[model samples]
Target: MADKRPQRGATLNRESNRFNLPERTADGDWLDDQAGIDGAPPRLRTSVTVERARTIISRNTSPDIGFDRSINPYRGCEHGCIYCFARPTHAFHDLSPGLDFESKLFAKPDAPALLRAELAKRGYSAQPIAFGTNTDPYQPIEAEWRITRGCIEVLSDTDHPLTITTKSDRVLHDIDLLAAMAAKGLAAVALSITSLDPRIAMTLEPRAPTPERRLAAVRKLVAAGIPTHVSIAPVIPAITDHEIEHLVERAAEAGARSVSFIPVRLPWEVAPLFRAWLDAHFPDRAGKVMAIIGAIRDGRDNDPGFFTRMRGSGPWADLLRTRFQIACRKHGLNRERIVLRSDLFRPPEGPQGELFG
Candidate 1:
């Protein structure tokens, strides 16, 4: 093994160095009198890339996905979850969805303005603007960027219906805005918690807020009269699956009004990235885990169909569904389905002549 440490500011092509990128040097690599390499230090380097969003609303024709339109305030998430399905999206920009997806993030600094303009359109039809469906709108970078906050503020100002899904406790920073919108019945939130195990969370979501802190966010949001839900998404088969019941139960106790789960989805590039993570973290169970995941995914690492992709299929899938339902029923979660009201939408007052007398 040569001293194949990653160089600072150097980006290895994902196509070229798929999984064989080295990190350490072997004794043979060093000359008889030369010293070994220490390698580059692990540090986060973030670049402020701005995107001028062409349109504010993204509509999904797929029936399985709930909402009709969604707005992603940012492209690429900084949470750094190894199993993120949104990673491949970076490829569209000629960027590797691997490290670049997490490190080289892009923000729609004009999203708030664009959203207001879109809402003010004369023919615009109102529906809940789903935020954070693709990438977390409230990732750690949000503290500084504030694009998500600004979008929420615009939605609040216009009395537009909105819903958010996020894994960051930093959402607490926007409680004032969210609570104000909730007062008008125009807002709802879903906290995506994958596991409660600190160790697993540390390795799985290295940069995301801790599970306990996220639960605290749930409690705080519910207390503020915001309809809050817990989304235990992408339940990794042999890893975080066992913590499902416990997570839901605790979330219920923490004041989450609804609960939902999505089985792990490994699509395209995500499959190999996930396998590498599994091999590195849980070497012994990596093979067993992949086997079980395949069983749930209908004898494949992934099923790209519209309906069965999110929930998966087969015995393993059925077992997860049964377990989730049983746990939800036992905890009385998602019982009422506190749906957000769309009738309260009001067209923007300042633009599109809506306020003309």
Candidate 2:
């Protein structure tokens, strides 16, 4: 029961990964044997590596997902959300999914050029491209890299349809571009707000924008004539589940045109990390929360199937669905899905520099 909470700027203790291909594990026992004391862990620092992506658009045909093409301007989000399913992706780089996933990040500096090139290809077809599917396109580093902004510029200029999802209010910084795209029926956005309680949000998503800030952003986007939605994502069973109705009501009042929720998913490395997070912050209800999640996930920490994974199975899942539906109905949210038009899409005129050449 000692204080397991991470230091001021850190979220995890940087544990070794169990899924690492080389199978590495840390042994503190050796240090104890030599110095009769445990060695202090290294201080975590955020590092950005530039990735020259050969292609910026990723295609997927998952039956559960709504989009076929998506773009992630960055990898390994710095938001440090304990329940982020994208955390496990760090394992592919031989890094710990715990602290390293957040501290070490990648940016696609050439995404805009690559995207333009791809769109200009012979058989390229217009479709709504999704952003922030794996990591927040507007994460903190975005302020310096501006990769997402560049991609947005290309999309807007070509009149290509695009959808964005993020928990950060930084999306508002692009209001001009987004508003223009929306006017052409080429843009929409969804903001994810998990809990209204700042204390819970601090512990769960240490670096993400506050829930209230996200709500305000929703209002701003809606007022600007952008089709905006609010996502009460990863509704923890015993913890944040109680706030579902209140969240929907507040979102509706804030001018969200639609609302949706997803049950907590603990896939791969996220399972252990989330369990540790629960023990640290919500020790009292951690067991109950995991039990309910197990019930929804069919006695497992995760369900990887196509359709069922998005919405878990079992009575708990059914109850969550019913509660969400009732709240949406009561608040008059989700009246219609925002559909962006792909017909307006036209390939960007070859590289901007070419005109001068």
- For candidate 1, the lDDT comes to 0.80
Q: How many residue pairs collide in each prediction?
A: 0, 0
Give the Å error, residue 253, model 2.
0.5
* lDDT by residue for model 1 (1-357), tens: 111122211122253134444322222112333454355333546676988878878888888988999999888887888788898787677666666677778988888888887888898877788999899998878999898889888888778888999999888899999999888788999999999999888777877888999999999999999999999997998899999899989999999998988888888767776776776678899999999998988889999998899888888889999999999999988778766667777777774455574
Q: Give the true-structure RMSD of model 1.
A: 5.2
TM-score for each prediction? 0.89, 0.91
Q: Point out where model 2 deviates above 4 Å.
A: 1-43, 351-357
Kindly provide the TM-score of model 1 when superposed on the true structure, using C-alpha atoms.
0.89
- Model 2, C-alpha of 3: deviation from truth (Å): 7.3
Q: Who wins the lDDT comparison?
A: 2
Cα lDDT tens digits, model 2, 1-357, are 112334322335344456535432432322235455355443345789887789999999998899999999998988888899998888877776776677779899999989888988978899999998999999999999999999999999889999999999999999999999999999999999999999888877878899999999999999999999899998999899999999999999999999999999999878888887887788898899999999999999999988888899999999999999999999999889999999988776765746864
The residue-level lDDT of candidate 1 at 278 comes to 77
Candidate 1 ranges with C-alpha deviation above 4 Å:
1-13, 16-37, 350-357
TM-score of 2: 0.91
